[model samples]
Target chain A: MAKVYNFSSGPAVLPHSVLAEAQSELLDWHGSGMSVMEMSHRGKEFMEIIHDAEHDLRRLMAIPENYRVLFLQGGASQQFSMVPLNLLGEKKSVDVVNTGHWSKLAIKEAKHYAKVNVVASSEDRNFSYVPAEDTWQCDPNAAYLHYTSNETIGGLQFPFVPTPPEGVPLVCDMSSEFLSHEIDVNRFGLIYAGAQKNIGPSGLTVVIVREDLLDRALRITPTMLNYRVHADADSMYNTPATFPIYIAGLVLKWIEEQGGIKGIAARNEEKAGLLYHTIDSSGGFYSSHIETPFRSKMNVTFRLRDESLNDSFVSEAKKNGLVQLKGHRVVGGMRASIYNAMPIEGVKSLVHFMQDFARQHG
Target chain B: MAKVYNFSSGPAVLPHSVLAEAQSELLDWHGSGMSVMEMSHRGKEFMEIIHDAEHDLRRLMAIPENYRVLFLQGGASQQFSMVPLNLLGEKKSVDVVNTGHWSKLAIKEAKHYAKVNVVASSEDRNFSYVPAEDTWQCDPNAAYLHYTSNETIGGLQFPFVPTPPEGVPLVCDMSSEFLSHEIDVNRFGLIYAGAQKNIGPSGLTVVIVREDLLDRALRITPTMLNYRVHADADSMYNTPATFPIYIAGLVLKWIEEQGGIKGIAARNEEKAGLLYHTIDSSGGFYSSHIETPFRSKMNVTFRLRDESLNDSFVSEAKKNGLVQLKGHRVVGGMRASIYNAMPIEGVKSLVHFMQDFARQHG
Candidate 1:
């Protein structure tokens, strides 16, 4: 069976070369006579893998020396609580922008640790656009301003980074779009993403935080949940997701070979352009509610003109070897999550299928 | 090169068959054209993987209907805090037994959430023995009795299950010895094991708890850290460690093929017996501090008569294709963690090397 384009929002696609490399080394990594999964996280081989992964990521992101990159677990959902538990030290409140599903969940979890102020929201428009920065009610006294850089479910992405009040920091959940584009690392106080999307597999979450923000965890924070503890220990406070980290290293290397984030971003723009063009020229057969400027370059969401054709559209798409194209259940349409790992060819295949499906139903 | 016996404590060895299976399915799983790593957690393929993993684990452990088996992340270290955070309820204090490294860590973390009673400790003897239950200063009103079933670093295991005071539950950290031997499911209120040993891989932690214990989580507990949230969501409260869970399913299937826990236990006993006998009959050339009955059947810790040879001993062991035999740095000596996946032949090879080394250095 030929490989198909997998457009799952997360735990999403990975570079085929990385998977091939991992397969070749699955049993005896570097002639160590043990699978990467079997090596101790403290062992030299595994340590090297983790170090290279961090180093490559730091290079790719052009991360500053002031930032600490941590490989964590429990996905982005765990961070929804951990971010507040660690950063909301003396501050009683945090300013949050509810862009979509992920941001909403983050707001809910943060409320358990601190008073949450909804600074801005796109819910008024079904989360199809990013709220303007001037409309945001920035809390000068809040611990930080939190927002989702890209909402996988809604396929809406912030066009610009929001600046927090003078004393407050900015924290962004870049889960779906991390590494798909280059960004100024110094612009944010913290950025985190689950590895499944562009990094590698599930089980590992990458956290990039300014080093100065390490010491402010609440008194009740668990040692594992404390960012300071992880940073102090080099993310080895305990047994980490060792194999996932190894695979992520392979992915980081692949990205470098593809000419770093800049090259990858160019490809992502081209892929998104092709898919969005198909949606725009569908002659009323398909529609995308997201405003042109806010449509995600990573996840392109659209719907058939007739909702009744949704099931057959999905089934027939699968038959043609394009799978996981169904949008999030909440949005009720179709979404093609063309992350960094997604090839332009895959997007072209998807666009072709979308056109065919629309013509038959039209 | 032939596969070597991997003796790393956690992130230890897994069966070759499982690795082969994983490799074969690395790119296109079951003709689905998407790697298991790429599938969405909500997708049917990934759902089936998680469900089968939980189901097989339940069957292998003979876990009762009242128990909720959760596939969590952050290894066992996360549970060190979560256990107390969720189970302490209105009880201000909990009882803890200091067996070794893991238990001591658990005790330290539990203190952040609850007042801890050091009911009993083997720390006086350098954690070489399990303190007798009769000697325990039982806190009758404590929330739970927390203990380490097996200490990976010190190679000490409790010979008998410590009975908590009536109405108090027992919480055991079985990170190193889970599925190594069979025990009554009713013997403890909860059992949590990090999946690096005797299971699949790192990043996924399995928690088996009584259903009734789920609701008592502190209001301050992070939603992801709360057991009730995980139980209700079937451990899918967020995008879980999907690939790790799938690998765990494969491991569970392998254990079943090895005749379930009972058969695995008999093999474990035999393997551990052979290695321990080599140390015991070393004619004072090597020694184990653990009391014979309390010695762990998973991790076997010992030392050479002459400490000067420790480094060379480890190097020579690696040359003989017996690697990761060096003990944890905290405990300076040697530790062979022969988990469920370590074949009898691996133990035999280690025993052979031990005798040869003693013959030259004795």
Candidate 2:
């Protein structure tokens, strides 16, 4: 089989080692004579696997004792609805920072369940930058302030956490940049990320919610979506995504093996820096929409100045084994999502591919 | 490692070959150079897998063109609330049949979202038998009449599909008995099952919903829990449980290889007969709580005449490679879940162990 690298944003690349280990255990997990997929969720074996995965996640994040880490199903989209349902108890309005596509979607979903206030937005700049926190309109008594820390499609990110109005809590959708950077545990009320990007697979969602925010869910909230029910049961109240949890655990183990988050962030910065420098040096040939200060270090979106060459670029790149470089349909161009499992070599190869592509069309 | 047969109800046993093949493809799926877990949900590779899985499932079940088969997350527990939220609309009442643990739990969740009528209940008999359908007091104006076709814990099953009153659709929770026997798909308005038992894994829930039932969800329903959203996208509005879907597809392939559901059901009956016969031949030494007529072909529930011998029977059985034979916590004693994957050899071995234990205890 020819070697290839996957560059799709989420449900993206994973370490080959994790997949190999999973394969080896597929038929007989830990000598149980049944695959993890076949083991009953109520069995001792699966319980231990889920428990260890949750513990490892909490440990990796250094989650404060007061916070609960929930391994939930239904990607971040579900969280968009769950967030408002769980926290909009008595408040009529929610403060939102609309930075890009994901945050805008979050706000749209929130509107169905609460009165939403767009405290700040970067939409005026075509979602290329994060709004300055000081130039904002926020409701002091609002239930919670929500923002997307990293916008995968726009390749933009919030450089720093936004402080919630006094007594209010800050919530972030850190889908793309979650494990790639160091985050303060106490600064936010809730942090959720779908597992397709920095985590493991696509089915799991990692929710880091404070303990105090547990019991405020609306009466209409489904029991499965209730944080209190999930937290109380330790995310096992229902059968969880066992195989994905195991894969995520393995990824967490790999992170620990590679010197934790600090090590990953360093590599991510180096990878992003190299690719951005290549694009910048290409003069007018290649350009990126997200301004330098707010650009994402994970998914680097760029396009050739000669838009007509885009099709040729993608086709030529595929011949060289680099795949999924096409940008999201909402933003037509190319995007290179270098997630945690993406090695330095993969980035170097991508930079090399970009330079070659740029030279052909420059 | 000792070869042990797992009889845990759900997360139960699967075809050994499926596990072996999954293990072989762990690191790289079909030369894609990425695990199915690693591929993006939207990418062609993973999409192909999901599409194939859905197709195989449709073919295996011979799903009608009017019904959409959805692969959803959050297990049957989530479905408990989702069913009423999606189907009840503005209706205040829904009818339910109480046979055992699962039906009772479903009714409890439904009460949170709608007024529930006890159409038929076997609780008067300690849930040991299914009430005759002719005696049911179904409400004609209810939105839907729900019943659990098989009770995993009580080892009880409805002998026949009850006729729903006019304007009421028949909904079945076949979580414990789906795929064990064939049923006319046209008889049900909706059929749902968690995959851990007769299908694939726990994270995936298969919902076969009628087309006409897709558009009436209440406004309070979360988008993820809305059947319409799933029906519209064909269950891919967001990232799905990829690995579970892959594993499930493999199981479907295995079923086809074994001559589809009909062939498997014949084998299942043979296996269940041997175990039930073993218990019957023991005379008064062993007996089943579920009456013979309503006894489940999927899960066999029984107890020794002398309760003290229960522990010894389980322990010695484990020593002889029989595992997870203990009954559910709610109903304690012994349970042998002979799902589609449990082979005849496993059943014969279980019978051999049962006879040995009976010789000493009886």
Candidate 3:
């Protein structure tokens, strides 16, 4: 069978080597005589798996000594509520920049715990461009400023991290683009990412929070949702997502072997450039509405010149081993989510299919 | 290499067949050309997997049509707070029957949301037995009566389901023994189980709530913790634990092929009986503190006549392919957690080792 290039937003494609390694150890992990899935979270074998995963992630991201890396469950969506529940402190409101679907969801959940101030929103322009930092209304008394580093649905990535007002922390939802590039850990108070994209699987969520910010959780917050509880226990406040963490550890090792984050960033840029170049050179047959400067390097979104050909373009592309290229239901067209694990060859195959489909229809 | 018997409480042993099948399909699921982990939650492939899992679980448990089976993240420990947050609507308190460590944790979390009434408690006896249901102090105004069906740490299982007062609903945490026996779903207003034990892997939680009970979630409940939100979206409110859910689906299928819940219950009984008989025949060499009538059929806890030999007993058992027999750290002794997936052969091997260890130490 031909290997298919998966382009689903998330759960997205993973490195073939990681999957093969996991398959080999599915039933017996390191001669422990138990699948990573069946081993107790508190057992020595699983403890090492989780510990090594955290260590590798810290090394890859260059996380500071004071930051607590929490492997949580419930994906990034749960973090939307937990952020407010844990960080709202004495402040009555939070500042949020609405880039697209995910940021909006975060704002909605934050409103349940505190006053939500949508400082800036790109929705006015159909989320085709990110609002400039200068245009954002900073709230001096707000708890924190929140933003999505990349909008998976709109195919928009913030060109630069927003600078929050002095004393107010900056929190980022880096779910889709985490680990694709090097990041400065000191710049943000907290950073969270769902593992399905670049990390590993769907169940595990990676939360990196500064040490001093752990104690601000609301008293009514559930123990599992409290960052302090997780930080205090080293993210073993509960059983945790054992198998997912194990797989994520393997992915982190893979990242290191592939030249760490810097290497991943260079390859990612090349893949995005190749696909975007194809769209640009298609003589308007394939056009991208996103402003080039703010366009996502992870999810490349484009549209066929004749809207009627969209269905055929997607279906025909699947026959040639390109799958999950259909745009999000809310925004119809084409989207190639080239996450960290998507090789250069996969993007090239997608670009070739796009050009051939455009020429045939044109 | 010979297969070894695992007895960790959870994430405990899964059927070898389930692990083998998962290993074979880790890279490509049924020719979809994508690992189940890579499929989008909204895609038809994942939709089918989740739907089939929920359907099989409902059938196996004989769940009523009005019940909504929700596949949620955050283990049962998270449900500790969610229970009170969602069910303690107008009521200011909840009735709780404390059986062991898990029940104590639930009560601790419940106190954050509502006043907790200790209707009954076995903590007075070091959680060695279940408090009599007839002796429970019924709270007419309480939102619900919460109890743990099986205490994993103490190795105690409730012999009978507690009947809540006419208007009060019954809620149960069946985490450790969820699918090991036949359960009448109508007996309770809600049943929740962490999937690490009998279901599949860690991270995925199953909540079977009666339809009418969904609307009781408090206004302050986090969106992810709210049952109504999950029910409305059919448990796809956001990116779920995709791979965990898929593996759980396979587990449910395995349960069906083994002749459903009834078959699993009979096998569990035989396994538990064999282990208990071995302990009883050892006379003063082995002793179980839990009373025979209320002893668990899942986790068989016992202490050697010479308590100082605990370490060697565990080490010797491991050498003989019986692992994780050391008791929970909190309650030191030996605990063999024989869940639904533990075969009769594994139990026999464990019994044989226990007899030999007792003879040598006696």
Candidate 4:
């Protein structure tokens, strides 16, 4: 079967070469006589796999020594609860910038444990743009300042990382845009991403947290939710998502081959650029609801000027082997998630199809 | 590369056919043009896969209509906290039989949330036997009776499921023994098994909860840890372990081919019988510490009488394409886990090799 472009938000696309390599080694991982899935997490073979995975990840991100990279199980949503449960230590409140869908979700879950100070919200404008950091009303005494670096649903993203008040740790849900570009690891007190997005597969969440923040967990925090427990055990407190982590290792290797973060970011930029350029040039036939500066390079959400053609547009795209091009239901428009693995050719094909669709109906 | 029989407790061996199928479709799943890992959890393809997985699992167990099956993350350890947090509703205590290592782990986590009643224990003799049910001191007012169905490290197993006090729910951590045989699902209010054992890969945990028990979660239960939340959303509260669930689906399909629960149980019994028979008939060469009728059919633990040959025994086994044969550190001998996926041929080879080793070392 010919491969087609998968534009799923996540569990989303992974690299083709990574998949090919995984396929070739699925039965016997480097002659260990066991699939990576079957190998014990504590075994020497798997220990090297995980160590190299962490080493490559640390090399990719230049993660500081004071920070611990934890390979975890639950997706980003679990971290929403874990963040407040673990980070709220003696403080009763935390600051959050409500950008869009994902941010609101984080805020909602955090509210269960901590007093959530919603510093700023873009919801008044249907979450189309990022609110300037100057407008944020952060509480200086807050435990931390948390924000979503990218909101996939509204296609809102910050052009710059927001600054937290003095002594306040900055936390970011880098789920959708993680590793799409190089960012200063020092800017974050903790950074977490669900592996499904730009990483490997779903189930394995990567959390990079500063050492000092590990012990701040509330006593009521579930043992599994305690960052320090996982940090201490090197994230092998219990059996991790072993197979997913192995695939993530392969992906990290692929990222290295593509010239690490910068090279892949360049590729991501080109793919997103082509799709966005097609949307911008289509004279009212295509429009992105997001503000120009805030548009996401990962999830390019756009709409057909003639809304009634949404079904035909999606069906035609499927016929052309461009699948999962439909938008999230909450925000009704097409979402083309061109993550790191989406080759430039897929984007070109999408741009070509967009032009043809616009011409046939324009 | 030749396939070795992996005897690691877990993440353990998966069916050869399942791995083959996954390899064949790693890049393009049935021409949907998306790998199982790449497809969106909410998409039609994944929905069908998860649905079929749950359906087959339910059929194999003969689960009643009132049960809600959830495909979850965080492994069995997460369920340790979750069981007490969710099931200890209006009650203040729960009954648990201390069978072995896994049971103690669960008790330690549960003690944080409830008053734990030690119903029975086999720890006095290094967990070599299950305590008789008649000796239990169950609390009638307790919320539930929890037990480990099989203890892999100490090779202990309950010959029969323990009875809960009248009106108290029976909860079992069937992680090591789930789906290995037929059981009366009606007796259990909740049964959870980490998928790596007798199932699929690690990280994905299967939970079967009687419907009425879903609403009993304590107020502080993390939304992700709440049984009702997963049940209401059909375990799609967030992006689940999609690829692991897919592999588990294939494993369930393989189980169906093996004549479901009963047939697989017969194979497991025969495998264990051959191994135990070898140890018993070896004069004073290979000795099993576990008491008869209380030994696990899943993990067959034994030691060479000399004990000095432990290293050589493991190394020799590896040379013969039998790997991961060393026992867990807590139990210093050997553990040959003859899970459902371990074909009869593998067990025969293991028995034959064990006899040869005993004769040489004797």
lDDT of 2 at A20: 74
Instruction: Pick out the ten consecutive residues of candidate 2 chain B with the lowest summed lDDT.
Output: B158-167
lDDT of 2: 0.87
True-vs-predicted CA distance for residue A93, candidate 4, Å: 0.3
User: Which parts of model 1 are misplaced by more than 4 Å?
Assistant: none
Write down the RMSD of all candidates, one decimal each: 1.0, 1.3, 1.0, 0.9
Give fnat for candidates 1, 2 and onward, in order: 0.83, 0.77, 0.80, 0.81
Q: Which whole-number lDDT from 0 to 100 does residue A341 have in model 2?
A: 91
DockQ of 1: 0.82
Model 4 per-residue lDDT at A268: 82
TM-score of each model, in listed order: 0.99, 0.98, 0.99, 0.99
lDDT by residue (B196-298, candidate 1, tens digit) is 9988889999999998899889988988899999999999888899888989999999999999999999999999999999999999899999988899999
Residue-by-residue lDDT tens digits, candidate 4, A13-128 = 88889999999999999988899999999999999999999999999999999999999989899999899999999999999998888998999899889899999998899999
Q: Which 10 residues in a row give candidate 3 chain A its minimum summed lDDT?
A: A352-361
Task: Report residue A309 deviation for candidate 4 (angstroms).
Answer: 0.5
Task: Calculate DockQ per candidate and list them.
Answer: 0.82, 0.75, 0.82, 0.83
DockQ of 3: 0.82
For model 1, residues A1-362, the per-residue Cα lDDT tens digits are 67688888888889999999999989989888889999999999998999999999999999999999999998899899899999998889999999999999999999888899999998998998998899999889999999999998999998888888897889999999999888999989999999888898999999999998998999988888899999999999898999899999999999999999999999999999999999999998989999999999998999888999999998998888888988888998999999999888889888898888877778
User: Candidate 2 docking: what grade?
Assistant: medium
What is the clash tally of candidate 2?
Answer: 2
**Candidate 4 residue lDDT tens string, B179-251:** 9988999999999999998889998999999999988889888889999999999999999999999999999
Give per-residue CA lDDT, model 2, range A1-362, as digits (tens).
Answer: 67787788988888777777777777778987777877777788888888888788778788889999999999899999999999998989999998878888898899989999999988888998877778989889999999998899888877898898898999988888878878888999999999889888877899999999998999888889899999999888877888788888888888888789988889999999998999899987889989899989989999889889989888888888888899999988999999989988888888898888877666
